[model samples]
Target: MSVVSPRQIAANLAELWSPRVIADVDDSYVKVARVEGTFGWHSHEHEDEMFLVLQGRLRIDMDSGAVELGEGELYVVPKGVRHNPSAAGECLVMLIERKSTLHTGDQVTDKTRSIADQLRPL
Candidate 1:
Protein backbone atom coordinates (compact mmCIF):
# COMPACT_ATOMS: atom_id res chain seq x y z
CA MET A 1 0.00 0.00 0.00
CA SER A 2 1.09 3.55 -0.63
CA VAL A 3 1.35 6.18 2.03
CA VAL A 4 -1.31 8.89 1.97
CA SER A 5 -1.95 12.14 3.77
CA PRO A 6 -5.19 12.49 5.67
CA ARG A 7 -4.61 16.18 6.27
CA GLN A 8 -4.30 16.81 2.56
CA ILE A 9 -7.43 14.81 1.96
CA ALA A 10 -9.31 16.89 4.49
CA ALA A 11 -7.91 20.09 3.05
CA ASN A 12 -9.14 19.13 -0.38
CA LEU A 13 -12.67 18.42 0.69
CA ALA A 14 -15.05 21.01 -0.75
CA GLU A 15 -18.08 20.06 1.25
CA LEU A 16 -18.67 20.61 4.92
CA TRP A 17 -19.72 17.77 7.25
CA SER A 18 -18.86 15.27 4.53
CA PRO A 19 -16.35 12.64 5.58
CA ARG A 20 -14.04 10.72 3.30
CA VAL A 21 -12.50 7.40 4.21
CA ILE A 22 -8.73 7.49 4.28
CA ALA A 23 -7.92 3.99 5.50
CA ASP A 24 -9.11 0.98 7.46
CA VAL A 25 -7.68 -0.43 10.64
CA ASP A 26 -8.99 -3.82 11.60
CA ASP A 27 -12.70 -3.24 12.29
CA SER A 28 -12.51 0.53 12.05
CA TYR A 29 -12.29 3.15 9.35
CA VAL A 30 -10.11 6.27 9.41
CA LYS A 31 -11.93 9.26 8.04
CA VAL A 32 -11.22 12.91 7.31
CA ALA A 33 -13.75 15.69 7.13
CA ARG A 34 -14.31 19.41 7.33
CA VAL A 35 -16.65 20.90 9.87
CA GLU A 36 -18.47 24.19 10.40
CA GLY A 37 -21.62 25.06 12.27
CA THR A 38 -23.66 22.22 13.80
CA PHE A 39 -23.74 18.56 12.83
CA GLY A 40 -26.92 17.72 14.66
CA TRP A 41 -27.45 15.37 17.59
CA HIS A 42 -26.68 11.75 16.95
CA SER A 43 -25.25 8.62 18.53
CA HIS A 44 -23.89 5.27 17.55
CA GLU A 45 -25.77 2.84 19.73
CA HIS A 46 -23.36 -0.04 19.21
CA GLU A 47 -20.03 1.70 18.69
CA ASP A 48 -17.97 4.54 20.02
CA GLU A 49 -16.67 7.30 17.76
CA MET A 50 -13.31 9.02 18.01
CA PHE A 51 -12.62 12.51 16.73
CA LEU A 52 -9.22 14.10 16.25
CA VAL A 53 -8.86 17.74 15.39
CA LEU A 54 -6.42 18.27 12.56
CA GLN A 55 -6.95 22.03 12.32
CA GLY A 56 -8.88 24.81 14.00
CA ARG A 57 -11.14 23.89 16.91
CA LEU A 58 -14.14 21.66 17.57
CA ARG A 59 -16.79 21.46 20.23
CA ILE A 60 -18.63 18.32 21.18
CA ASP A 61 -21.77 18.85 23.22
CA MET A 62 -23.55 16.09 25.07
CA ASP A 63 -26.31 16.11 27.61
CA SER A 64 -23.83 15.45 30.37
CA GLY A 65 -21.36 18.11 29.30
CA ALA A 66 -19.29 19.60 26.50
CA VAL A 67 -15.66 19.73 25.54
CA GLU A 68 -13.59 21.81 23.15
CA LEU A 69 -10.65 20.40 21.27
CA GLY A 70 -7.96 22.28 19.44
CA GLU A 71 -5.62 21.08 16.78
CA GLY A 72 -3.68 17.90 17.62
CA GLU A 73 -6.27 17.02 20.23
CA LEU A 74 -8.80 14.22 20.19
CA TYR A 75 -11.91 12.98 21.94
CA VAL A 76 -14.07 9.89 21.91
CA VAL A 77 -17.81 9.83 22.19
CA PRO A 78 -18.92 6.69 23.94
CA LYS A 79 -21.51 4.37 22.52
CA GLY A 80 -25.15 5.47 22.92
CA VAL A 81 -24.18 8.94 24.13
CA ARG A 82 -26.07 11.56 22.19
CA HIS A 83 -23.74 14.31 21.04
CA ASN A 84 -23.69 17.30 18.76
CA PRO A 85 -20.48 18.42 17.08
CA SER A 86 -19.98 22.01 16.00
CA ALA A 87 -17.40 24.58 15.07
CA ALA A 88 -17.67 28.33 14.81
CA GLY A 89 -15.04 28.38 12.11
CA GLU A 90 -13.77 25.85 9.63
CA CYS A 91 -12.17 22.81 11.23
CA LEU A 92 -10.42 19.77 9.91
CA VAL A 93 -10.97 16.52 11.73
CA MET A 94 -10.06 12.87 11.51
CA LEU A 95 -12.39 10.26 12.85
CA ILE A 96 -11.89 6.62 13.73
CA GLU A 97 -15.05 4.61 13.88
CA ARG A 98 -16.39 1.09 13.48
CA LYS A 99 -17.02 -0.15 9.98
CA SER A 100 -20.72 -0.44 10.67
CA THR A 101 -20.96 3.00 12.22
CA LEU A 102 -23.36 5.35 10.54
CA HIS A 103 -22.31 8.91 9.78
CA THR A 104 -25.16 10.41 11.71
CA GLY A 105 -26.03 7.31 13.63
CA ASP A 106 -29.79 6.70 13.94
CA GLN A 107 -30.57 10.29 13.11
CA VAL A 108 -30.72 10.93 9.39
CA THR A 109 -30.53 14.57 8.45
CA ASP A 110 -29.67 16.42 5.25
CA LYS A 111 -26.03 16.36 6.25
CA THR A 112 -26.05 12.62 6.85
CA ARG A 113 -23.60 11.02 4.46
CA SER A 114 -23.84 7.41 3.40
CA ILE A 115 -20.96 4.95 3.73
CA ALA A 116 -20.79 4.73 -0.03
CA ASP A 117 -20.33 8.49 -0.25
CA GLN A 118 -17.50 8.38 2.28
CA LEU A 119 -15.81 5.45 0.55
CA ARG A 120 -15.36 7.35 -2.69
CA PRO A 121 -11.80 8.16 -3.71
CA LEU A 122 -10.35 11.49 -2.76
Candidate 2:
Protein backbone atom coordinates (compact mmCIF):
# COMPACT_ATOMS: atom_id res chain seq x y z
CA MET A 1 0.00 0.00 0.00
CA SER A 2 1.21 3.53 -0.72
CA VAL A 3 0.07 7.11 -0.79
CA VAL A 4 -0.34 8.80 -4.17
CA SER A 5 -0.76 12.48 -4.71
CA PRO A 6 -2.36 13.72 -7.89
CA ARG A 7 -0.35 16.90 -7.47
CA GLN A 8 2.89 15.01 -7.29
CA ILE A 9 2.12 13.02 -10.40
CA ALA A 10 0.99 16.08 -12.27
CA ALA A 11 4.14 18.01 -11.35
CA ASN A 12 6.37 15.28 -12.71
CA LEU A 13 4.43 13.90 -15.65
CA ALA A 14 6.09 14.29 -19.06
CA GLU A 15 3.61 12.81 -21.48
CA LEU A 16 1.59 15.16 -23.63
CA TRP A 17 -1.67 13.25 -23.86
CA SER A 18 -1.36 10.12 -21.80
CA PRO A 19 -3.26 9.38 -18.58
CA ARG A 20 -1.84 7.53 -15.59
CA VAL A 21 -4.05 6.01 -12.97
CA ILE A 22 -3.53 7.27 -9.46
CA ALA A 23 -6.58 5.72 -7.91
CA ASP A 24 -9.32 3.23 -8.69
CA VAL A 25 -12.47 1.78 -7.23
CA ASP A 26 -14.73 -1.08 -8.17
CA ASP A 27 -16.46 0.61 -11.09
CA SER A 28 -14.45 3.79 -11.66
CA TYR A 29 -10.85 4.96 -12.06
CA VAL A 30 -9.23 8.30 -11.37
CA LYS A 31 -6.49 9.10 -13.85
CA VAL A 32 -4.07 11.97 -14.10
CA ALA A 33 -3.31 13.28 -17.55
CA ARG A 34 -1.12 15.91 -19.14
CA VAL A 35 -2.40 17.26 -22.41
CA GLU A 36 -0.97 19.86 -24.75
CA GLY A 37 -2.69 19.39 -28.06
CA THR A 38 -5.92 18.30 -29.68
CA PHE A 39 -7.36 14.89 -28.93
CA GLY A 40 -9.35 12.83 -31.40
CA TRP A 41 -13.02 13.48 -31.89
CA HIS A 42 -14.89 10.62 -30.31
CA SER A 43 -17.68 9.48 -28.01
CA HIS A 44 -18.58 6.82 -25.52
CA GLU A 45 -21.68 4.84 -26.29
CA HIS A 46 -22.31 3.49 -22.83
CA GLU A 47 -20.50 5.69 -20.36
CA ASP A 48 -20.17 9.25 -19.29
CA GLU A 49 -16.78 10.87 -18.56
CA MET A 50 -15.88 13.61 -16.14
CA PHE A 51 -12.84 15.82 -16.52
CA LEU A 52 -11.53 17.91 -13.64
CA VAL A 53 -8.91 20.49 -14.32
CA LEU A 54 -6.12 20.50 -11.79
CA GLN A 55 -4.03 23.11 -13.50
CA GLY A 56 -4.04 25.10 -16.75
CA ARG A 57 -6.93 25.02 -19.17
CA LEU A 58 -8.83 22.36 -21.12
CA ARG A 59 -11.16 22.96 -24.03
CA ILE A 60 -14.03 20.73 -25.00
CA ASP A 61 -14.87 21.11 -28.66
CA MET A 62 -18.43 20.26 -29.54
CA ASP A 63 -20.43 20.54 -32.73
CA SER A 64 -21.53 24.05 -31.87
CA GLY A 65 -18.24 25.45 -30.59
CA ALA A 66 -15.69 25.00 -27.82
CA VAL A 67 -16.07 25.52 -24.09
CA GLU A 68 -12.92 26.42 -22.18
CA LEU A 69 -12.43 25.49 -18.54
CA GLY A 70 -9.82 26.81 -16.17
CA GLU A 71 -8.27 25.43 -13.03
CA GLY A 72 -10.61 23.99 -10.43
CA GLU A 73 -13.44 23.73 -12.91
CA LEU A 74 -15.03 20.49 -14.08
CA TYR A 75 -16.97 19.32 -17.10
CA VAL A 76 -18.87 16.17 -17.80
CA VAL A 77 -19.34 14.76 -21.26
CA PRO A 78 -22.49 12.74 -21.59
CA LYS A 79 -22.63 9.40 -23.28
CA GLY A 80 -23.04 9.42 -27.08
CA VAL A 81 -22.11 13.05 -27.56
CA ARG A 82 -19.37 13.56 -30.12
CA HIS A 83 -16.72 15.83 -28.73
CA ASN A 84 -13.02 16.60 -28.75
CA PRO A 85 -10.66 17.88 -26.10
CA SER A 86 -7.67 20.14 -26.61
CA ALA A 87 -5.10 21.93 -24.51
CA ALA A 88 -2.98 24.79 -25.69
CA GLY A 89 -0.33 24.40 -23.03
CA GLU A 90 0.60 21.75 -20.53
CA CYS A 91 -2.50 20.81 -18.51
CA LEU A 92 -3.05 18.62 -15.50
CA VAL A 93 -6.43 16.97 -15.23
CA MET A 94 -8.22 13.91 -13.99
CA LEU A 95 -10.36 11.59 -16.10
CA ILE A 96 -13.03 9.41 -14.54
CA GLU A 97 -14.07 6.52 -16.72
CA ARG A 98 -16.19 3.52 -15.97
CA LYS A 99 -14.45 0.20 -15.74
CA SER A 100 -16.33 -1.20 -18.70
CA THR A 101 -15.91 1.90 -20.81
CA LEU A 102 -13.57 2.18 -23.78
CA HIS A 103 -11.66 5.43 -23.93
CA THR A 104 -12.65 6.05 -27.52
CA GLY A 105 -15.69 3.90 -28.05
CA ASP A 106 -15.57 1.88 -31.30
CA GLN A 107 -13.51 4.46 -33.12
CA VAL A 108 -9.91 3.37 -33.01
CA THR A 109 -7.25 6.03 -33.04
CA ASP A 110 -3.60 5.98 -32.07
CA LYS A 111 -4.60 7.45 -28.74
CA THR A 112 -7.32 4.87 -28.32
CA ARG A 113 -4.66 2.21 -28.14
CA SER A 114 -4.25 3.16 -24.48
CA ILE A 115 -6.08 0.63 -22.40
CA ALA A 116 -7.36 0.85 -18.84
CA ASP A 117 -4.90 -1.87 -17.86
CA GLN A 118 -1.96 0.38 -18.74
CA LEU A 119 -3.05 3.17 -16.41
CA ARG A 120 -0.30 2.65 -13.85
CA PRO A 121 1.64 5.18 -11.88
CA LEU A 122 5.33 5.93 -12.39
* Cα lDDT computed for each candidate against the true fold: 0.96, 0.81
RMSD of candidate 1 to the truth, in angstroms, is: 0.6
Steric collisions counted per model: 0, 0
- Candidate 2 global lDDT: 0.81
TM-score of every prediction relative to native: 0.98, 0.88
The segments of candidate 2 whose C-alpha lies over 4 angstroms from its true place after superposition are: none
In terms of TM-score, how similar is model 2 to the real structure?
0.88
lDDT of 1 by residue, 1-122 (tens): 88988888898999999999999999999999989999999999999999999999999999999999999999999999999999999999999999999999999999989999999888
User: Candidate 2, residues 23-120: lDDT per residue as tens digits?
Assistant: 78788877877788898898898899899999999999978777899999999988888889999888888888887777667588777646644465
